[model samples]
Target: MRTAAELKYGEKGIINDIDGSHPSSRRILEVGFTPGQEIQLINMSAFRDPIAFSVRGTIIAIRKDEASCIKVL
Candidate 1:
């Protein structure tokens, strides 16, 4: 039940689900973070507010708040 935000740098995870009620859920999905997708933490900002993830052949940067809504394992 861990969230994407909880994944350590360079760790990989499978997307379990994204909170449908979250405002950024749609945007997240559009970026290829759909359920069952494989994702990896690629980078993080200096303050760790925004984190970069590798998924579906591309890198995506999302705020920590929005990332927390994405459950992973």
Candidate 2:
């Protein structure tokens, strides 16, 4: 498994699991990042702070810190 943030440009994967107990995890799940959904790494800034991705057919941008808590396979 790998982190959502670890996906390179144009990489794609299913949301295998979320591996944290933080409240952010619940919020992430609520945002259509549930297990078994597909996600694609769309782009990243020069600093790679906020990474862009397609989640459940919608493009969403998340901070790298939040992406680290999302596991994909």
Candidate 3:
């Protein structure tokens, strides 16, 4: 499994598992990023700072660092 940001643009994947501890992991869950959920990499800037994605049918923008914590299948 890889991170959501690691996914190529327009790529889609199901959430497999998160490789992190509490708080950050808990924060992701609170935002609807759960195991088995679908996610898509929408867009990225030239700097590749905040990557956008569609998660649980909602468009969400997050930093690459945060996306790295999320493991995708």
Top candidate on lDDT is 1
The order of the candidates by lDDT, greatest first, is 1, 2, 3
Off by over 4 Å in 2: none
- The superposed Cα distance between candidate 3 and the true structure at residue 31, in angstroms, equals 0.9
What TM-score would each prediction reach against the true structure?
Answer: 0.96, 0.88, 0.86
Candidate 1 regions with alpha-carbon error over 4 angstroms: none
Spell out the clash pairs found in candidate 2: none
Off by more than 4 A, model 3: none
Tens-place lDDT per residue, model 2, 1-73, is: 7899899889998889996675588788888888898999898988887998898778888888889888998
Residue 12 shift from truth in candidate 3, angstroms:
0.4
Could you report the Cα RMSD, in angstroms, for every candidate shown? Answer: 0.6, 1.2, 1.6
lDDT of 3 at 66: 85
User: Which is superior by TM-score, 1 or 3?
Assistant: 1
37 in model 1: Cα distance from truth in Å?
Answer: 0.6
lDDT per residue, candidate 1, 1-73, as tens digits? 9999999999999999999999999999998999999999999999987999999999999998999999998
Local error of candidate 2 at residue 42 (angstroms): 0.3
Model 1 residue 2 lDDT?
95
